[model samples]
Target: MRVIVVGAGEVGTNIAERLQDAHDVVMIDRDRERVESITYDQDVLALEGNGTSLETLEEAGLERADMVIASTDIDETNVVICGAAKAMDDAFTIARIKRTNLLRTWERSEEAFGVDFMVCTDLHAAEAIVDIAGLPGARDVDSFANGLVRMAEFDVKPTSPIAGETVAEADRYESLTFAAILRDDDVVIPEGETVIQPHDAVVVIGSEESVREFAGSLTPAPTLEQANEVVVVGGSEVGYQTARLFEAAGLEPRLLERDPDRARELAERLPQTLVLQSDATDIDFLVREHVDESDIVVAALESDEKNLLVSLLAKRIGVGRTIGVVEYGEYADLFETVGMDVAINPRLVTAEEITRFTREHRTEKLAMLEHDRAEVLEIEVDADSVLCKTRIREVMADLPEGVVIGAVTRDGELITPRGETVLEGGDHVVVFVDTEVLDEVAAAL
Candidate 1:
């Protein structure tokens, strides 16, 4: 598909960079430096111009585009850009919105902004934070088949029970499969003979119960002894939404904000949450306010440095778990190295979400694993495909080494595929694949 991305900002650049590997991506940005940078850095056509201009869209070959993604910083500009693209070409349009109010307005009337899909960076990031916080020992987690099947990544510790066990021996869970392991920067799709090492991040996919049990065997998140003891150290949109999600999940979270006005505002909006107007960096204040008693500490400050400091402070004070929201993608690894359990990058979350829509294949759901080393895609099998009438075990050799069919859903029923389980024409298959073999798996199925 010829996809046109109309921004060279963080989110747009990431989307274009990832999509360029599989699709013909054209990026348009008014900034000359960004346009030149992307042109030199990525395998995509970069154009410098106002994206909202009709002439710029024409120059970008909008007529030939299968999809148009407007991801500029300005929400109104993105909406206008999508609307313009919709008027000219018969292409699917996607708009990035930073504000929830604009999203709400668009949601009230479907296709209000001529966008087939809408992605909000803050919301995606907040939801990801919530997902990780809700699960014990999960640095990253994604669900498939209506939460029946889940894949979670756990940072292996020296004290972990299965640290030195072979994959075959460690994977004793009936419903679980060790999907992939991250040893330092390298991604390993573990074989049965592969040995699990300490400090390696292992990803596993299985039934919810089985995954939870496996997570518990590792360095799991500390359990919340009290009902409302989660501390959120920011009043930003992501922080506010994280608190909101916690409230929805029956957890009373305390939110701390440095700005008095913002803290008061959050207090009013989040009546259930105990909003504190104090600097979270102050160890004295944290101890005085009893923030140390909280089981989980979420750092969602605007600055990456501040978030890291908050996480470090929480850890120093013996907070059960510390999750840091790092804005820059590079800082995520640093956070992991510094003992921050989870680092949620909003840009990566938004990029993964948008990249899924840009895929030519009919992908129902998609997630990135191991710092984008691999992707888990849930694709509906077509009738004419080679896998339509074959039993999975028979085609084991033909399937790529990096690809593993995690789960199958037929007629809305989850089927745990075993050696003898047959694949039908229209089965919704959940596949975990190394990025190298993504195209091969897509072609096979």
Candidate 2:
């Protein structure tokens, strides 16, 4: 497939690189330096032009392109490019929109603009923060079906009760599956006799109910609590979006904005949150707002330096946890040194989400597996497929290279199938496939 990606910034470059392995990708940007850099380093077509213009789309051969992805830093440009592409051909149009208001408004009538998909960077970043906040101990989380099923990574501490338990004992938890164990640099595929030691990172999959049960069985359960009081510095779209996420997760959010009218508007838009018209740098104001008692302090101001400064202040003042949103990807590492718990780059996050959604076509949803080189895909099997009539073990032998059935779901029931388990018609099968043979696996199914 031919794909055209607009904006050669972090998001555009990442998307082009990801799709290049599967599709003929072309990346465009207004900056000559960016275009030259990506063209020389990556195996993708890079063009220098104003992508939002119709002439540029024509030059990029949009009519023959299977998909057009507008991931420019500017939301308006992305929307305009996507609109132009859709006007030319309705194949598939995706835009990376950063403004929260635009997304909320567009979502109400997205079909009218012929937008096939909308990627909201702020929303994606907020969701990631919310997930980490909800599961404070989890290093990473991947949710399916909007959170019905989740796979989480928990670091096994030295004080954990089950530190030295074997995998067999751990699997006895009714709803849990001990997926894999990450010990330092190695990832162990556990068997019945495999023993887990202290500092081992364990990945588990199950419904929320079962996962909670599994979490409780650990020697020392990690803390999971909603933030009663939250502090958000900076009134950027990312900040507002994060505030909204906190409110939705039942956190009492207090936003600190420098502009009074903007703060008032934010207060009106997010009635659940208390928007205070005060400079985040004002230590007296922060103290008066009881920043010391806040459960979480999020630094999402425009300047990375400002965010770091505010976060450091919040941490020193005794906030439970501090998260900073870094606009520049290179500054991400500095957040950890400065005491911020997590540093999120919305552009990087949005790029990754868009790449995952666009690179693969067969599956409705795709998630990264234990190894970054592999993927776990949920595909709906055709009713009359031959594999549906055969036992899972037999089908495994005939599966295209690099694919293995991980699990299957029929009528909302999840089943871990063995050789004897038969695949029924209308089943949603979760298959793990190496990146190389994804297409072949899809064809086989």
Candidate 3:
């Protein structure tokens, strides 16, 4: 596949790095230093030019490319580039738009923008946050099988239903399956004899309905209206989007902005949300506003240091959950270690979304779990594939130590795989595998 990527920033560079080995990648950027840096660090053709220009797209061989991805930081520029690319060829076009309204306009009718798909970093991150935030103990949640199936990660509490039960004893749900457990730093691929322990981070896969039922049974029922209490700190696009999503979901979320002008604008834009003008990093102001008493505190500040400090202060003041946006990928782990319940990096999230397009299998969906420790893939079984017409027991034995098939879809029905279950061609299977064994699992399948 010939992929012409516009922009050589973090997200574009990541997409290029992942696709270079599999696709013919050509990256365009106006910054000579960024182009040179990507050229030296990655095996991609780095072209320094204005991506929105017709001549630049032509220079990057847009006519022969299979796909053109516009991922510049500016949403308008990306939309223009995709529209321009479409005029040249019928290549699949994807545009990364940060603003939700612009994204919605293109999504309603792509003819004007010529965008086949849209990736909104702010909206996606906010959705991710809402998925986990609404769930009491959940750290991450991703859906597959067109929202019928879900992979959820959360810590096992002492009062959890499955905490003291072995896998066999806990196999009460018809669709729920325990995929893996993270104990300390080790990822345990559990079996029937494996016992779930308290504080251990567990990953579960099942139909959306059944998984939510199982989750409710595992943890104490959240207080009525508890999920609606949320405090968002930051006036950035990501922060505003998060507040918007929460408000749309019937939650009157409070938004804090250090800039009075931005606060006023947000108040007008989002009448459902409580917009306050104040620095979130100030512990006195946070306490005065009772921010720490909220169900969740989200730090979407521009600087990583501010986010870290705000989250730490929130945690110290007894916020039920603290989520921070880590500007740098390297600081994500540190943020989590220091007390933030979840540290999300927009660049990494965007990269993960793009990776679904580069898979070697018939992957309908893909998501990174446990901070990239494992990957959840919804892949279809080809007629001639090794996995076709295989017994579940033998297939499990043949698979590597860190991989497991969580669910199978046949004829639009979800199937929970057992030892004697036989998998046939045309079945869509959802598998959870450690990052190290992803290649082996793909090869075996």
Candidate 4:
């Protein structure tokens, strides 16, 4: 694939990094520093020019690009870039925008805004938060096989019940597959006797019910349905979207906005959400509203610092869980380390969405894990494919060491892979591949 990525910010840079190993990538940015930095750090051509300009697109070889991605921070600029790129070539175009309104407009028609695909950053981040909220003790969650199969990453705390158990002991769930254990810089493909240590990010893929049961065994907290008390501390777009999604899930979440006009608008827009016009930093206001009694507190203020402060306050006030919306991707680990149960970065979420779209035709679905250290891919088996009609035990010898068959679905039914199981054509298989051998696994499977 020959890919041209506009805007060398976090989202664009991440997309470029993910595709550089397998595709010919070109990146464009108006900032000289960003261009130089990406040129130094990645194996791609970096051009310092306005991406929306025709001459700049030509200079970046847009005529030959297989895909063009517009990912500038500004929503209008990204749309303009995609429009310009689409007017030139037959390349697949993707745009990243922060507003849900723009996405709704694009969905009204085919190839709207000249973009083949669009990813809304704020909405994606909010959805990520809601997904994490539903599964207790899960640091990250993504669904595959049309939501029939689920993948969850749990940070095993020292006090967690399964922290010291072996993989065999923890394999109590019927339809679950222990995909990988992320221990520091290493991606460990666990065996039956492999011990799950504290601080290990354990990745599991399986049926929705089995995954939820495994999540329940990890922590004592109830699921989002059982624990309906959720407080959203901000009226920012992400916060508003988060509250709306929770409401759609049959939850009446509380939203706090400092500005009176914004609070009134939110109250009118979100009928199910309880909108309170008060500064979230005020201890008196939180106590008066009974925020301390909430099961989940979401910090989605305008700035990362403010969100961090609110998350810390929520923790101090005895909230069961805290989900912080992090503007900067680098601060995600920092927020999690400082007691935030989950840190959702909108840019990273947008990048992941766009990356998944890029793999649409080849793979049914894709989920990147541990910042692209590994990926979970859903691929349909065909007669000519290597996995077709193959027994699981025999197929394992041909696959690389890091590849794991997580789940299989046929006729809309879950088929857990085992040593003696044989796969057939038309079956969908969810696979976990270490990024180091992703290309090899993709070819073999």
TM-score of each: 0.96, 0.84, 0.85, 0.98
Candidate achieving the largest lDDT: 4
Model 1, 120-207: lDDT tens digits are 8899998898888767788888988777788888878799889899999898786887878888777788889999999898888888
Q: Count the backbone clashes (under 3 Å) in each candidate.
A: 1, 1, 0, 0
Candidate 3 local lDDT, 253-359, one digit each (tens): 89999999999999998988999999887889988988867878889988999999899999888787888888678888877887888998887788788778767
Compared with the true structure, model 4 gives a TM-score of: 0.98
On lDDT, the stronger of 3 and 4 is: 4
Candidate 4 worst ten-residue window by lDDT: 353-362
Task: Name the candidate, 2 or 4, with the larger lDDT value.
Answer: 4
Report the C-alpha displacement of residue 172, candidate 3, in angstroms: 5.9
Mark the regions of model 3 whose C-alpha exceeds 4 Å error after superposition: 53-59, 155-174, 182-188, 194-200, 209-225, 380-390, 394-401, 410-413, 424-427, 437-440, 443-445
lDDT for position 99 in model 2: 73
Model 4 lDDT tens row, 281-398: 9987788778999999999999999999999988898889999999898999988898888999888888888887666464888888878899999998888777888898888888
RMSD of each: 1.7, 3.6, 3.4, 1.2
List where candidate 2 sits over 4 angstroms from the true fold.
157-166, 182-188, 194-200, 215-226, 281-288, 359-362, 368-376, 384-387, 390-407, 416-421, 430-445
Q: How far does residue 383 in candidate 1 sit from its true spot (Å)?
A: 3.6
* Comparison by TM-score, 1 against 2, better one: 1
**Candidate 2 weakest lDDT stretch, 10 residues:** 218-227
lDDT, candidate 2, 144-234, per-residue tens:
5445466666778788766898988767655466767767766565778999999887877666666666666662323335346777888
